[model samples]
Target: MLVDQNDQALRIGPIHRSVAAVTLSDLSELSEQRGDSFEVLTDRERALSCWTDPDDDMAAFAVSDGQAWAVLRTKRTHEVDATVLHESLLPAWHVADQQVGYHHSLDQALNATSRQPGLVVAVRPPTLAQVMDAAARGLRMPRKSTSFSPKPRMGVVMRDLRDA
Candidate 1:
C-alpha cells in the first residue's frame, strides 16, 4: 500500500464476494496442460489501476512504484513473456534467507542447483532505520521487497445490501 506521506490511503478493491464449487473434471484436463513456471496475472480479476491510452492500446502499470513498470497490451490476458521475468526487468527487493523446506523442491523439479535462487520476495520495504538496523546485524533484505496489496481499490463505489 504505497500511501501519501500525509497518510492518505489508496483505494484497493472490488473483490469477488461469491464462491463456487469445482468438479474433478474441471481440474483434470486443465491440470495436464502445464503452463510455464511463470503465469500471467489478469487485471480484470485484480483490484489494479489501469490507464488506457487514446493514442494507442499500449498501457503502463507500476508493478511497484519506483521499482518496476510493465507495458501491456489491451487484451484480456496480456501475457508477458518469460524473458521479462528475468531480474533485469524486475529485480529482487527483500530476499535474505535462502535455505528452506522447499529448497529441494525447486532444485529437483527445476533442475536448478542455486543455493539462493534469487526469487521474488513478496514482502514490504522496511523503513530507512530498519534497513540500517538489518545492515548492522549483517542481514540483507529480501529480493524485490514490496507490499502486496490483497485488495487494491475499494470504497470508491459502494453497493447497498438492502434496497431503500
Candidate 2:
C-alpha cells in the first residue's frame, strides 16, 4: 500500500462525508476520484478502535471519559447535560464477538469537530459488517484507521495461536 508524504501516522477514522453522510460506497467513489488507495486490515478475530488526527499535536478525544467531557465542556462554553451525556453519549458501544458499528465511531469523530475547531481526532471501532465487506471486496481501510483494544501489555489477556 502507498503511504502519505507527511510521515505522520493517520490513527484511523470512519468517514469522509459524502451525499450519504458516511457510507462505504460513497467513500470508495470519493477515494477513486481523489486517487487514493484502500488498505484493509484482514484480521477477522479482532475488533478495532483508535484516535488519530492530521497533526501529532491534535489529540481530539480524551483517553479518559472525564478528559473528553472537560475538553467538550470547555470548548462549547455551556453547562453540558451530564445526565443526558451519561445515559446516551457514553453508552457502551455495541460489539459482537468484538464489533462496534462504524456509525458509532464516525459519530464520535464528526460530533467532535462540529463546532469552532473543525479539527478532529477520529476514533474508529471495527464493525464486523464494514470490515468484512471491505475485505470481501479486496479493499481495506487506510492503515492506522482502526485499533484493537486490550492492546498488548502485561496483565492483559494473552493468547498463543501456535496450536490453532
Candidate 3:
C-alpha cells in the first residue's frame, strides 16, 4: 500500500520516525575538514530550530561538547538520497566505519553524548516517493535509512491448515 499523502490509512494516525548518529569525533574537527560543504551553527538553539523545519536536502549535525552544529545541504540538482550521508557526511567527519552508532530516536542520540565525547547527526527520513524512485532505478538505500510504523503483528494473518 502507498504510504504517501494519498493513502487513507496513513492519514488516520501517521507514524513518525527519526534517525540520529553518534560519533566519537568532535564537531570542530569535522567542521575544519568539511567547512565548505556544511553550514556551521554554533548556537545550539539555532541548530535545533533548523531541525524543526524538515528539508529533504538538509541534515543537521550537533555536538554537545560545545564545538557547534553543522548542516549539510546536498549538492545534487535532482532528487536526493541516503548516499549523501553514507558517502559524504559520515566520511568527512571521520566516522564512516564502526566509530559511529545510529539511534532510532533523537533522545537516545542526545543522551549518548554524556557518556562519551562525540557529536550527534540527525537527518530527515526518506519519503515514500524517494524510496519508490530509488527502487525503480535499481538503487539500494543504506541500512537504517528509513523506518515505517504500524508494523504487522506476528501471526495476525495466520490461518490453520485444516481450515483451508
Question: Which tens-of-lDDT digit does each residue in 28-110 have in candidate 1?
Answer: 22323322122224432231234222212222221211122222222222122111222212222111233211211212312
lDDT of 2 by residue, 86-153 (tens): 22222311112121222334345444444222222223234545556767988645433444442345
Best by lDDT: 3
Candidate 2 has what TM-score?
Answer: 0.23
| Count of backbone collisions in candidate 2 | 7
lDDT of candidate 1 at residue 61, scale 0 to 100: 26
Q: What is the number of backbone collisions in each predicted candidate, taken in the order shown?
A: 21, 7, 0
Q: Write the per-residue lDDT of candidate 3 for residues 47-87, one digit (tens) a residue.
A: 66765564445544333433456554444333443456677
Cα lDDT, all candidates: 0.26, 0.31, 0.54
What order do candidates take by lDDT, descending? 3, 2, 1
Can you give the TM-score per candidate against the true fold? 0.18, 0.23, 0.64
Candidate with top TM-score is 3
